[model samples]
Target: MGVRLRTAMLAAALLVAGFALRAPFDQLRRYLIARCNDPVRLPRLAEESRVRFQPGARDCAARVAEMLPAALARIEQEQGRPFANPPTVAVYVSYEDYARAGGLGDASVAAVARSGYVLLSPTLCGDESERLAGVLAHELSHSHIFGWRRSWFAARPPSWFTEGLAVMVSGGGGAEGVDEAMAVRAMARGWAITIEDTGLWRDFGAIGFAAEPPPEIFGGDRFAGRQRLAYREAQMFVAWLRRIDPQGFARLLNRVENNESFKDSFVKIYGAGSSRRWSEFLAGVSR
Candidate 1:
């Protein structure tokens, strides 16, 4: 009985250690994949430009290398700060490889931002050069946010702000299929993305969200069309906020990047809760 107990305890200890060490292990795995899988590093375009691509995808890699400087500069200009560190971009010719290398989000997503690197999908490398730039800029925006904030801060913002701000910065990359007119029509029909200044713990961990609309209504699957509409509405709302108060928008971005309370900073900057601001946005859309 004593030997059995010791064996069980040892097993449990090893299991716990694995769980504790998984993040760093996974991070290392991703870095290796980024470095090894994409063997061809393109010509240097800027101090921060380190783009890697597979041989089959050299043409796309060249495009990325060409556009990266302007894209990074544009994102920095819009976000009001420089990237804390240069992002290493890995462009893949296969969706399977991209997924294996820590790409999150649905397959339709063009690019995904990791902590210090980016994974670009094959579709974005095609003839859609315009879309390629937008998607690149969008992911870079996420990279900028990751630079300054804690890991948990990534999930702290309401999805609206996170996706919407990226959409706005990229000039409609994520919400490409839907436009302002279509989003307004959906809002008029009672389908709209909810705007909330989420608390630090709202969507973190296993805690259930306070009874809110369904996820599909918020950011749904690609086939349902709800996701695109939600993204578009979110972008429009963010744009409205900036247009109504440019200085206030800048201050809000500063506060958010500095790890301030999103809810408090928003109210302080705009003089009202998100609900009120949302209503004003709706009114403006109606007009």
Candidate 2:
């Protein structure tokens, strides 16, 4: 059987609260942002999306919408939850156009999840739908997390936990793939931060939104000296931990979402030995 197809689908911090978007948009920026974001509605795509376009990328929005069912299903299956609301999706022909139009940045950027919308760029979505699915799934994970965490506390999950889960769920070879390769090469050379190093976990608090947002906030070495590698390591750690103990994963996230400290939450579910387990996992990966 050919089967059926369906379609669907922030930022960090205020990206979580999404609606509180600092009104950083000036006349031109606001206009452009609104153009893509509040696009005139097109016919509904599959079960979820009503494709929207900003004259420049109608095809891009349609392309992503065409792939939404698989992406949403993956998120639901991985997270063990369904979305409370369908995410608003805006597609740009390429990242460069999106940045220029929205005052965001170049085509290197793929998508951003906001409180109410998922902004996408087809620039790197590749030629095939299958290739693009991973990116869609990854961005959708962020949207899902942003929505789910609000009921517990305003605070967002640590960068590692959030980004790690997104990468883990995405079948695409995202930054995690690069992170893994980098870790392996680094490990071979006997260079890796200890699992116990707190730096391994990203602190979102240190990021200052002094201006709209620089490229570093999205990805790069701006946060920590080893920030990129730390992200990869964090993804590996969290994903593996979840695999070994899903019940613990659920409980740990529940506690953390409600503002529990990572160590406290880890012990509450997996016993104090959880830290030992983490160190062991780290050693194996680095070895």
In terms of lDDT, the best-performing candidate is: 1
Find the 10 residues in a row with the least total lDDT in model 2: 201-210
Give the Cα lDDT of each candidate.
Answer: 0.72, 0.57
Tens digit of per-residue lDDT, candidate 1, span 1-287: 69999999999999999997886676566566656544334433343358877658777887888888888898899989999888877777877777655423245556778757777888887645557887888888878876667656343666677677888998887677678887777777667666677733322211122232345544545343555666778788888889989999998887777777778888998999987999888887788
Candidate 2 residue runs with Cα over 4 Å from true position? 1-48, 94-97, 100-107, 125-131, 151-153, 176-182, 188-231, 256-263, 272-278
Cα misplacement distance, residue 75 of candidate 2 (Å): 0.4
TM-score of 1: 0.74
- What is the clash tally of candidate 1? 0
TM-score of candidate 2 against the unseen true structure: 0.64
Off by over 4 Å in 1: 1-49, 103-106, 127-130, 151-155, 199-221
Candidate 1 lDDT at 233 equals: 81
Query: 1-287 in candidate 2: lDDT tens per residue?
Result: 22232221112444545544443334336456646644334334444454455565555666777777778888888777787567777665545555654334434455656555676666544443344667677778877866655643344545656666777888532453355766556544554334431212123312111122234433544333244454455567777888888988988766654455666667677775544876677667766
| Candidate that scores best on TM-score | 1
